[model samples]
Target: MRQVPTPFPLSQRIPEETAFDRRELAAILSLYGRMVAAGEWRDYAISHLREVAVFSIFRRTAENPIYRVEKRPRLRQKQGMYAVIGPEGQVLRRGHDLPMVLRVLERRLIRSVD
Candidate 1:
């Protein structure tokens, strides 16, 4: 009989740290909460990958995500670190400052007073 080989452990392949920090989360979640209260958003998800971290927002559980806030460390030097992508895969904004990048989404909160 032939012997079988066991697979390696998962932890060994993962990195030690994440790209997004507490300050970034705070800024993102703060806006998210406000949008939620406004009834513009309902669900959200977070993903930390080897190259990037993504915060996805959805209007409903079954529907596709409305926006994706991504943090890519590699792009920090080139096109800033934070980026907000629309549902259609277009970049709404990209900047080094998290709060500034997020401002693009906040603009949607405005409405005509008339």
Candidate 2:
């Protein structure tokens, strides 16, 4: 009997994790900073998965995230690649541009100012 060698090791065979690029992170962080300064957002987490990247915003460290910004490259053609999801798992906004999609959070900043 002969054994066939895999092209990639088992540890590396899965699809590469998707993540936010430098420019995307910069834009997201800029909004995060503003929200933090406004006292509307307190914490955040970033996650890279096989098919999506997420940036979750939290009002407190121990609570569930209040909002989540997501990137799904697989949806880039049909429904855009970016989305803003509310705490209840509702889609607040979706678009191809990161800054534009993030305007949903900016609205929160507006409400906080009043």
Model 2: per-residue Cα lDDT over 22-58, one tens digit each? 9999999999999899888899999999999999999
State candidate 2's TM-score. 0.85
Runs of candidate 2 with Cα error greater than 4 angstroms are: 1-14, 112-114
Best by lDDT: 2
lDDT of candidate 2 vs native? 0.93
Which candidate leads the pack in TM-score? 2
The list of candidate 1 runs beyond 4 A from truth reads 1-17
C-alpha positional error of residue 86 in candidate 1 after TM-score superposition, expressed in Å: 0.3
Alpha carbon deviation, residue 67, candidate 1 (Å)? 0.3
lDDT by residue (tens digit), candidate 1, 14-111 = 56445678989999999999999999999999998888999999999899899999998878899998999999999999999999999999999987
TM-score of each: 0.84, 0.85
C-alpha RMSD in Å of predicted model 2 compared with the true structure: 3.5
Instruction: Report residue 100 deviation for candidate 2 (angstroms).
Output: 0.7
